[model samples]
Target: MKKEKTIETINPTTGKSLHHYSYMSDEAVKKAISKCHKAFETWKEISPKDRAKIILSIGKELIKSKEELAQLMTDEMGKTLEQSRQEVDLCVAICNYTAKIGPKELKTEDREMVNDNKGRITYAPIGVVYGIQPWNYPSYQVVRYSIASLMAGNGVLLKHASNVTGSGKLLEQIYQKTDIPDGLFTVLVINHDQSDTVITNKLVRGVTLTGSPDAGKNIGQKASAALKKSVLELGSNDAYLVFEDADINLAVKACVKGRIYNNGETCIAAKRFIVVEKVYDEFRDKFVEAMSNVKTGNPNIKSTQLGPIAREDLRNELHQQVVESVKKGAKIACGGKIPNGNGFFYPATVLENVKPGQPAYEDELFGPVASLIKAKNNKDAMRIANDSRFGLGGGIFSKNEEAAFEIAEKYFDTGMVFINSFGLADPAMPFGGVKESGYGREHGGFGLKEFVNIKSVMYR
Candidate 1:
């Protein structure tokens, strides 16, 4: 496939052109990689404490430009302005968290050898790590990996989604405002083929991606074939289980927030709501009512609860999923309609009688659409939650905290689980998923080591 010469970003809210960017040529990308590798030579020698100092400054810079950055993300990807601000806040939190723990996490450790010789383990910075990120949570997705990798002394490169190209360039500018080196945190405005060339570059040591499973497979394969390490945080159809003993009101409220937050374009958003037969009718009634009342309109408005779907094609794809699911016997209790308007708006939809062999039940509906599945009992609810091929994160809502914890730990078959709440990534806690949702973890000090070379040295 031939690489395009230019990339254009459109405003999803208005469907108008916001900016046009020229893709970096192959020579430009190679030079960028070489520059990053050169910077890495000096950056890798810096102490973790010094790196944390710069990272701390980055957090301050992010807050200083929070409003501007937030608005740019809103204009680029159709996320609500307030949500964009919150995304900036999350990025700041990640920066703060990475700075606080990075020094200790990346510090060298002394250990005893088998023959009683002195042994030391050093977590050294690898070369430039390339990240291919999605448009959803643009700031958070970039900051999530870049901050940790920078703190670990590795140079960072980004290939942000084309729809959020402005966000990516703005982030690069934000990083430049801090003490970070020039090429240490660079954003490549290149297409897919150039990205492949980057992965094969000898200067690129590690790769990480946050996208769909198919994308993960492609990048993972390329990185593996090149013998470079990769970390993937793929998509998920996270289930929010409402057990028989669960509080119907609390479950409904949290599930609704989980589904609709970020306009329901989140990777870990509660897509599946599995309710026990005992309380299915009551929960379904209240859930459908809440979803029906959700406001959908311009993202800039303060009162809008749902924004445009980021792109026209994405909205159309979501509608097709709803249509296919309906054909497979799923019934739309509320929403499920694409609005006849200028913007790519998808209503907060709910599908009931959701069963296997339906897109609503099998695959991820990456929008404000909910799949309400009925389980015979608590055991059956667990079974349905664990039935999917993707296992990123899930939730177990029950009044008995202990029982929910046990389920989260023992039976959930996911990376992270919420007991009585619906929450996204936390800087203090480890985040990532298992199975097709992608391997490896991010956040909570775990991400700091993902791109580091753990070297062992012995002295006799």
Candidate 2:
């Protein structure tokens, strides 16, 4: 008999293993997919309103276990307990919002065809949707796609990041407590090879992933080969522009929040700060001072602003990016050194003199690191912001709301733009990107239709 491989979840704050899960066997994976598809057969036939009711009850289950799940998330991924709670809050909101709007969003529409014929457009569920989510904001990441898919009448499958396997399992448990049928939301504790096999499974219909561009490419290719639709929310080196007419205080505060939120591991968080020359000096000094004040410690503590890097290898990779950027002419304004510690902790860092060739300017530093770039003027700032392969999200700060909106609408080429404040995903807004950041929209009712088949029914 062969020994089964296992995936271990670690406590990023203590550098200790928290839990381990055995990888599902190929037979088990196949069975799970078949079971989910079997459930989808009945799930799809249920009315959207009935599906929404079941989906909304999942929120109640989540709230019941909010504290335990939040602790599990913090212990696994090193986000502060407060942030972990907030993640759960967002998940709950997702369930509530999905339930509120899903029936209407999925409602059949009537249209008039040529020659006075009647046409009906139906949004039908495809089948099982496989979601590959990241560790940061573990709960929200899982719920963001899962709830919408559930409301759309598709069975949900999750291959969550191995580092946060515990959170994924907990979510499965929560879903089981709901009235949803068994296997409707299955968590596959499997390795990369098994995941690929699952993607090619005939029972699986569509795929969605929130990971790096490289990972997206691999998964997207596999899905394409299988003739399955995929939604990839890839990486981004998002910029927050500080224009000449911006409020220096407001910009600095929001920029710091944008850079360090989720310990700066967020795909959409501001990684680059593009400031006009008129206010570069002031913004840099203030931003660095505020970031320097951020304390890195145990995520269980409420006052801690930044946590560990979620894994030691991730911390090392982030440090290497910082070192290479420095060697390439970017200067560390504050907090560049890797501290001697028990956990995978990296300090909140800001890089100045950031140029195009440096990693600080070129790559997505997936930790609490900030890149400060100076632009000649407001127009130059917009140009600098759009100068990236990533177009997920960006921010523009100006006291003039109309001008800021104009810049975001017309000039910022990303999928989402923040006018003044920094925020993560909202349940009501469309979230996704263009170019290398991946395509297809999630949230804001857009996600409900992502995996649905829009069929046109005509009557003569």
Candidate 3:
């Protein structure tokens, strides 16, 4: 449980220290795990109504601290202050949404009994749940999985992203101050050493991770070795498909937001654009123009539309991807270069004629770069979109909603589809994907069910 002796959180926009967090020692890990094990039984027995009340109270606390949370997220992630506020709002909304909806959602489903004297099927907690959350969408990611799991009578043991360590501690503090039962929600700061053992421990029953494929592969393998359930949301290289019938103005508008939201760090972001041959040039031009129009500067300003990258390494990697794409014959339609600044600033970028070997088509560039690839027709567009290992979220834009739906259905690799729209998600809808994007849903009732153990008590 030895944590990082010193983990610094720097403002990606300023290259300055915002704060520092200490990692957990092995002794601390054992303590937290012990607490979680000690707390699970009581937490499991707590009525759903009481859990909901506590969740609502936590939600209210988050709302009250909205300004502070927003500022913190902005400083750590380099999202615009405006977007940061929205993230806080979304976090509050998700908490409230879970509080209000969790009871109904987690309510045991009545199953037909085979035997007259025995019982039927029901859902129950699987004991102490481990949540290894990501840095992007810090609040929502933790709450999305942990909150639902908590409502399902499972206590949570969280290992949030190292970069957002403060965010994790702050959340734990909020819950602790609310008098939420201890061990019900604990954020242990274990470093790389304990990562492998973190799941194998006997007290921990389940593990959920939102991270890279390589990380997911290792965790999934270890979790599987222990015969525990592992929910791996390994993310994706989300493809954006545009039919010729799409509204150029509308497509361009969404492209701007979709590829730049969260500094284009969203897992299901439209990293690749597949355009129908008929309107390829027109769509490319509009996309470039819209990208050029995005305002990039200080993240704290209300007027700023785009912000700096969340980390220097992320900025550098994104820059390298764009460079490689261009080198492979993709025409740099717009951006493709970082703005002159000390901050980790990569401007909104759009590239056209994105070759098959380029990152636009092959890799998931987690930044503000959009790659445009041309297709002869809808069939060809679908072919290009599905020609990748990742498949999380994608969209089809056409004036005809039916046609858009058809195209979305035609996409073989993706999980969620947006008809005549970008991959903007809702809390009430199921969000996940197929292929290398990983399995498991992250929203709606499906997300809640991810935390529950469906059991059948049949009497014969």
Model 3 pairs in collision = 1-25, 1-26, 2-25, 2-26, 3-23, 3-24, 115-459
Model 3 misplacement above 4 A:
1-4, 113-119, 410-412
TM-score of 2: 0.99
Query: Over the full model, what C-alpha lDDT does candidate 3 score relative to the true structure?
Result: 0.81
Q: Residues 38-89, candidate 2, lDDT per residue (tens digit)?
A: 9989899999999999998999999999999999999999999999999899
Q: Which ten residues in a row have the lowest lDDT in candidate 1?
A: 1-10
Worst 10 residues of 3 by lDDT: 112-121
Model 1: lDDT of residue 158: 97
lDDT of each: 0.92, 0.93, 0.81
Per-residue accuracy of model 3 over 77-110 as CA lDDT, tens digit each: 8888887777767767776777788788767666
Superior by TM-score: candidate 1 or candidate 3: 1
lDDT against true structure, model 1? 0.92
lDDT of 1 by residue, 1-460 (tens): 6656788999988889999999997899999989888888888888999999999999999999999999999999898999999999999999888899999998889999889899999998888999999999889999999998999999999999998999999999999998777788999999887899999999999999999999999999999999999999999999999988888999999999999999899999999999999999999999999999999888999998889998898888889999999999999999988778687889999999898999999999999999999999999999999999999989998989998898888899999999889999999999899999999989988998888889999998
TM-score of 1: 0.99
For each candidate, what TM-score against the reference?
A: 0.99, 0.99, 0.95
Off by over 4 Å in 1: 1-3
